[model samples]
Structure formats: structure tokens, C-alpha cells
Target: MTDQTRISVGLQFGTQPPLNTLRAFLLGARAMTLDSVMVIDHFQNVFPTSIWDRDLTWLAAQRDTPHEFFDYQVLAGYLASRVGRMRLGVGVTEAIRRHPVLIAQAMMTLSHLTARAPILGIGAGERMNLDPYGFDAAEPVSRLEEALQIIHLCFSTQGPIDFCGRHFQLHSAPMDLKPARGRVPEIWVAAHGPRMLSLAGRWGDGWYPATVVSPREYAEKLAAVRAAAVAAGRNPAAITPALHRFMVVAPSEREARAMLDTKVVRAFALMAPPSLWRQAGVDHPFGERFNPLVDFVPGRYDRETMNAAIAAVPSAVVAEGPLLWGSRNQVVARLRAFGEAGLRHVVLAPVSGLVSPRAALYSLWATGRIARSLRRTSPGDGTSAPLLC
Candidate 1:
């Protein structure tokens, strides 16, 4: 593995934190000089209710209630105005919920507002966001493929568009707005499966996969992406390899483990299919019980049930998964391993107690420390500097 590589570090802002907490974290990140900030695009709460409250009866009562989530585009614009230096973007938005033209226009607007082209991360539809809203969740990959094509046309083409696909169609669609930076925002695609990986290689400027993927798995998938890029006649090096994972920085290993044992983290792990757990070498207790294919419901379980299920799993098993939790040095070492494994970008999603103001501030400080350590120890003989994007 060559160490003469550059890595961009990003922080992910999701619905788990309240708006105030998110604002504080962003301000702290800017003060600490982190590279970029990305926000998740979700109409509903992706975090389990247990994370917010531990009381079983209270959780059950609020299970049917809507969760708080800000619109990502609007939030990105807001954050951009507040934090002028840090690159702002939506970690990912689904093509199913919003049209390609609108997404393109929104990104362009963000670019003009921020004075830099924001990263537009996209993915196929997730059932959690689609099913309740009555959007067609079928053939998500097909819809995503067509959506990518349309989005590309909207960004690159000069005149009106006329496209007809199985899932979406456009007839003389007007896309008159040009990007403020003289180019559209870089499109990053979140993909896990083989088909989606190929699409990322062929069309995306960056490839993003969930953090549960092991470093070895990331290497394999990245190889596949490079092959697909070569087959498509695009420069493979142009596609940035980005990984999104939850992180917790603590003073000791035990404290880190305790933080990862929260109901939210356990429930999040349970939502991953058993195959992914096995791939990550996680010995999860809920084998095939909450498989997305069989369960069909988004999240699969409510707070009480998920809490019970997570309680049965061993902490060691959870520790073995993709979460980055440890002392400062340990966290830095793990990140170095990932960089060695061909990861060019990493987006850290702080979990559990780290979402709190005090812990989040500490995490930001630790992140600055880690970023400096990576740069100092990075294998290149002090000649090539890693780009902070």
C-alpha cells in the first residue's frame, strides 16, 4: 500500500442531534479547522427513538409521532452562510423524492450561496423515506440510474432537455440556471451493491459507502469501481473513495465501548443485513430476525423491541463492527489503516454521548488533532500535501 496519498475528512450532521446541537458542532468544527460538513437527507428520523429517551412507555407512545428533521437543502444553505470556509453538502439525497432538475438547481443555488461548488451526494430510494410518503419504492436502482442521467444532462447540457426512460421522462425541460462556480457540484453516489457500484464508477465523482463496510471490503469494492471506470473510459483516479462511519473519541477504550453500546448504535447495527454483519466480522445476536428483505418495514422494530433485541447482543460484538471508538491515538491508527486500504475521504458521524455539546466539542478538538497527526505521519516524504476538501 502506498502512503503517498491525500485524504479529505468530513463531519456528517444528521437528525440525531437537535438543531442547536448541530449549529454548535458546526461552529466548533469550523473553529477546529475541519475540512467539510455533510448533512444527511431524510424526511423522517433515521435514529431510533430509544436514543432520545430510555423510558419504554414514553418511547412506545411517541413511536407513531413524527420525528424532527430539517430540509437538507435549506439546512445546507443555512450552514453555508454561517460557516463560510467549510465545504457544505447533503451527505446524500434520494432521487425518488425530488426531481433531478430541482436537485441540480438546488445544488447550483448552494454553490452560488457558498461561493464554492458543493458536493451533491445521491443514492437510490430508502424505504424509510419512501414507503410512508407513498413514493414508488420499486425498481429504485433503475430510477436512480435514470435520475443520474437526467441530473448529468441538467448540469452539462446547454439547451432544454428531452429524455424518456422507463421510470422518468422529460420533454423540453428548461434548465437555464448555471452554477456560480462555472461548474456543477461534484456528484458523489452512495452505493453498496454491485450494480450501484458500477453506476458510481461510471457516473459519480465520488463513491460513498456506509461505515459498516470493513476496510477489506472497501478495498474490494473500490477495485470493482476502478474496473468499471476503466471500462467506461473515465479516469479512475477522478472518483474519490469516501467512507461514512460513526465515531466516538474517549479517554479510554472502556468509555468508548460504553458509548457505542447505546440503544441507537445497537439498533443501527441490527438494521444492517446479517450478511453485512458477517462481512464485518460482527457476531450479532439478531441473525436473520430483522433482515430488511423479510421484515419489509423500515427500521424493522420499534424502540422497545429494538432495545430488547440490542440488550441481548454482547458489547464485544458491537465493538467489532465499523464504528471508530477509542483513545486519540487508537482512533488515528485505525484511520491510518483505512487510508492505507485505499480510502481517500472519510466522513465521521459522532454517535451517542458525543452528540452532546461538551462531548461534541471534545470530538472536534480530537478531530483536529487526528487530522494533524495523519498529515504529519503520512508516508510521503513531506513533499505532497493532502488536500483538505
Candidate 2:
């Protein structure tokens, strides 16, 4: 484990782009001195219906939709060729959507091509995609555990993997590809629950958690994850803890707030549990009768209605907490908190809009500033390296 307060930053795609958007992220990440770049693996767009129309053009150009033959494996190959040094990975591939053998194969190919720069981030599959295929989302913990074991076996051995599990079975199917780099590619498991955390502790090289808002929350989760790793007979501290924060960095807090209003609020309204808003002491703008995620009919959103819906939730409750937003200084201050909490990396996920023109520029600017700040600080030597990887 590194002793420095190492900050390995990266970005996840927010929309389909014209290649230039990706170029911007790649360049921005480089400028910021970040260590990794990633993309989420999903067959379909994961946005609310209301925003789909506005998002389709970008999405189509950026990725192959779910069930489509054109997939990330192809894109990753091309990306690996073009981008150098910054580690690349699927932020997470759904465990139920593909077999571990296939996942390992793709990872191995990318690893070979990129000189073992690709890191594998796997998670339990989403029901929206797997249920149609007769897969059970209810068994995510068990399923993810099985998938990890299988993928590990395939990657580490020359002979075929032979194993049978409740969710998966592999027999004499060896992974023939060898990584060009001597080191095997790193395996990361994205998890938020204790059960999955235990699994990560035992097998994962890294742990990726969803949008972390505060240093307190980040520290708490790390504690649990490391504890689980220790209990599983692994060195908890060896595992790298990374956070993916929905960020909107600006010159000032006011502009960031407005961006949050127009973009973040609407975007989250579609994916986050509405109950979270209620926890913030806010009412559901669409009324208890309406689910904002219902199939969106394009050109149907009434501006007044939408604005009111967004306003129904308080900014303090909705945008600020559990998210990184505001001026450059503010974001830097918070990031330092994360460093103090024993985090090794933080992925700044700009709002979909921010990942574009206005926000992209700021994000690029902030990256450099942040990387410098982290380099100046030293992660203390209070703890021994525990295997959290």
C-alpha cells in the first residue's frame, strides 16, 4: 500500500459523445494527474424517460445500447490503443448479464493490449436488464460472489477453470490469453452493502462505492469494508477505496447551484430513490401518485411543471448533501477531507451537462488544481497495509 495520500482520479461517461467529449475527459484526466479512466457497462441507456429524447443522439454516438451486438469490448479495445498510462476499466459489468468466462476474456484481451492497464470492476446485475432474461436480481450477493470466484480462477490459471456453484458452473474451460504485462489486471467489485463488502474484502483488489457526499460517509464505509476484509482473513488496508462523486465544480457556488437545478436535480429525479428526497425533508414534486421515471414521452415536459418539480426538493437536501458541488475551493476542501479519511482515489463524475462545454472546461481546470493539492499532502503512517484490495 502506498503511504502518500494518493489520489487516483477518473471519469464515467454521462452521455454518448462525438469522441471529442471523451477526448476532453482523457485530456482533462491527464492534466489533473489522475491515474485511471472508466466507463460503465450497460446494454441500454440508464436515464429517465423525460430526458431520453434529449439524450438519445449523444447516447447512440457514444455507446452500443444493451442487447446490441456492438459492445464496450470493441470500444475498450480501441480506447486502449489510443489512451496510454491512465488505467481503463468498465466501472462495473453486471454479473448476471455476462458469464465470468466472457468477462475475464474481455478483461484479459484489454489487459494484454493495454499492458495490464485495464482493471475489472464487477457488480451484481440490474433487474431492468436481467429480469427479461429470466435472471434473478434477488440473488445478487450470491451471484456476484460466484462470478468473482469464477473470473479469478480463469484469470490466474493456465488450465481450464473447473468449478460448480449455485449460480454458475465452469468445467475445463481455461483462459488461453496471457496478460502482456507480468502482473494480472486488478479486479474491483462495486458494492454498498455489508454482504457484498465481505465478498470484496475476500477477493477484490479495489472497492468502488456509489456517489459519496461527505467525508464522514466515506470514512464510515471504508471502516466497514476494511473490517470485512480483515474478518475474511485478508489485509483490509491493501484494498484501495475509491469514490465516484457526482461533481459540478464552478467558479462560484451560485453557478454550481443553478447547474444542479437544471441538470443534477432532473437527472437524479429519474434514478435515485425518491425516498431520499423525503429523508431530506422535502416532498415529491410529482406528487405521491406519480413516478417521475414512467416512460417519458418526448416534448411533453411542461417547463413550469418541471421547474416546480425540481424546486419541490430543497437544494440543501437534494443537491448538496452526499454530493460534491460548489466553487473550486469548496470542492478542494472536501476532497482533502476524503484524503484524510484514508481514500486513495476519487472519481469526479460531473453532471451530464458539466461533462460538456461549460462544465468540462471547469472540470479540466479543477483536475490540475486538485492533483497538485493531493501531491502536497502525505497520508499518515498510522495503519499497516491491510488487504482491502
Q: Could you say which candidate leads in lDDT? A: 1
For residues 1-389, what per-residue lDDT tens digits would candidate 1 score against the true structure? 24455566888877433578788878877876777889988776655544445332233333353366778887887787876677788888888899888998999888788856688989886777778778887888888899999888988788889999998888998898878855468898988889999999999999988743466778899999889999999999999888887777776666666666655566555555466556555544545444442233435556566666677655544666566777767776676667877887788876644334466557777777766666664543332322211
TM per candidate: 0.86, 0.81
- Candidate 1: C-alpha RMSD after superposition: 4.9
Please provide, for model 2 over 1-389, each residue's C-alpha lDDT reduced to its tens digit, 9 standing for 90 to 100: 23476566776653244567667667767665567777766544444344433232244344443123226677778678656777888877867778888888888888877744588887776654564456666777898898888888877777767898998887787677866667577888787667877777888888887744556767887888888888878888789888777666677767766666654344454443444556666556655544332223223445555545555666555564555677666666667667778778777666634334566667667766755655554533222222111
Q: Supply the TM-score for candidate 1.
A: 0.86
Best by TM-score: 1
